[model samples]
Target: MRRRAIPLLVAAVALAAAALTAPAATADEGAAPAATATDAAAPAAGADDRHRPRLYTPAANPEAYSQALDLARAGLYRDAAGILAMVRTPQAVWFGDQSPAEVEREARQVVRDAAGATVVFSLYNVPGRDCSGYSGGGANTTAEYQAWIDAVARGIGRSEAIVILETDSLALIPSDCGQDDAQGTKTAARYAEVNYAIDRLEPLKGTKVYLDTGHAAWHGPASITPRLVKGGIAKATGFFTNVSNYQTDSANSWFGKLVSACVAYVGEGGDAAQCPHQSWPREQADAWIAANVRTPSYQWKHFVTDSSRNGQGPWVPPPGKYTDPQDWCNPPNRGLGARPTLNTGDPLHDARLWIKISGESDGLCLRGTPGPEDPERGMVDPKAGDWFREQALELVRLANPPILPGS
Candidate 1:
């Protein structure tokens, strides 16, 4: 039997058709203008993942390693949509090497390369790019944030884009900054912010949104579920776990299962026999949920991932270090994992995306330039990411038969 399709019950959404490319495009699903960096609405923005050591993305196309994207398209079914970030604090500015023009060109190339398939993209520069502050952060007001979202909307509005919205905003948005640590106000406001975001985003067509639920360690079923509800999961596609950080796929699965259970339970009433809209009866509820708890089809088709640098899973904590080990910063021994793609099995899970690209280091590593001295490299490792690209190509090729160069 065919697996169930993820039904994105968005409260509000929006879509854009194509860049001046309407003439070159055909009907797929989404509507909007061609997504260009400039097209991406401003503020509204923001946005790791898991360890499978799976040789997936680059393995599909050896050519990406040796050929131009145009030439490599034949063999590679998909490619990654690396981090597309922006800042709106002092003013609007993008945060990647490729110029806005280059970013737009490559993004469109991805659209063309995929043929009719979907390309999963992550828009991570939401005002507060790094919730922790420091890099690519902003938007003190909701209106400012919405303006940013409008910009992102303009960027991908035109395609059948599967977007993973802010990674852990649902679990983090704080309400009042004035209070001396009022968790209640902070969480309450996050709910409102996310809900408003969904309303703004739903306007776009064919866009599947996944809210951020931090790595498994950060939350539990009861905790995340409430946040998800507040974030408007009822209207969203669903919530995504493990973005930017690292947890094994097995660990992520366990976490995902618990959250899914909570979602079912939340929607289910206590009196199973009298539960309204009861799809699975009380007796079968347990078994049914177990059987239906959305196992990620090996299809890995429905999801998107950042094969940017995960060849090796997260930084294993050194023997004794808990306080900012700096593993998140560009560390040694890291290789690229899966590339970004649009085939996620669960509709709620837009795509296993490379929201965080490797080229852009998280910050300084344990050994590298320790702070203050060299501020130029906030989190960029030009030399490091280049080496991983080769590894990425190898992995992508392994997953999909190597694409013959120039084919």
Candidate 2:
């Protein structure tokens, strides 16, 4: 069976041929001349009025924007506005497929575009990323990865950046996918590589680095806490969950708290096995935390959650479906989640981010069958990182909190 494909940097393409086309691009996604910053219309005028001062809107994809413009020319104003709403909003800028010098230049360009505002970078170039699965092709060796990190750090020198270090790096490793040796040499290198990244990037004057902890549904606190420790959460900002997966915000918050508490407990001479997990009854878990963890909230590690595509929550695949449901792979009918923000009320929760680009595809999902068509949708899905018009429309149409005001 194939592994899940997480979002990463890729050249955006125009929509594939299909009729009954969804929304067209807004002004931001239109054939507007390419620039350092986004030209798309925001919810309101001015940064302060539209959202917090921290949000950094990046440039939109020309091809996706042009497709939206065509829809608008045909009187698809509603659809065009919806597509515009997605690209204009502040989301992470992915960096992985570039050479070290190229990445440094691009990273520096983003910093200049932010203009003193905070920006999110989903850094996904860890060696053997996605277990050489759908989104493979990272650096060939650990040394190469270190050089890449060095360039990224230099690019962002003295600029505000929220670094979402390597998605699925800690959660999914070589050992988990049968890609490691008997002595687990590759797995050990993976840990060291993550630690090296933390050591290099965390020290930057204006950078805050968060490690990956997968999502709430996949790894509970007890299981992921130790991995976070092994991956160097002690010297980092914290961990991020639900990067390219759909899990409700409430669930992600609760899971984050459990992991934070477990990390504190283990740091203070407690065993990871005894820490409460997500599966424990709420009352029982609360009581356990009350009795054991005495660390102040501020001192404990903080976390962030991805709200980009959790608007409708996770899809429930039909019973007796395919042998492997592949629920995370472009599941049908998912909507956009909450908009990205820096003011999450919970101290332990850092921000609700659109870590995954909302409109991009999650690869050609096979669902463990021979045919190329996805049985559920009756169409072959787009390759990962491509502009998935059908899925993009579904997201806009079903977005939670409504992508447009008064919609």
The number of the candidate with the highest TM-score is: 2
lDDT of each: 0.43, 0.81
Residue-by-residue lDDT tens digits, candidate 2, 99-196: 99999999999999787767789999999999998888799999999999999999999898899999999999999999999999999999999999
Q: How many Å off is the CA of 234 in candidate 2?
A: 0.5
TM-scores, all models, native as reference: 0.54, 0.88
- Model 1 scores worst on lDDT over the 10 consecutive residues at 83-92
Angstrom error at residue 81, model 2: 0.3
The prediction achieving the highest lDDT against the true structure is 2
lDDT of 2 at 112: 91
Could you report the Cα RMSD, in angstroms, for every candidate shown?
Answer: 15.3, 7.0
Off by over 4 Å in 1: 1-117, 125-129, 175-187, 269-308, 339-350, 366-407
Displacement of the residue 241 alpha carbon in candidate 2, Å? 0.3
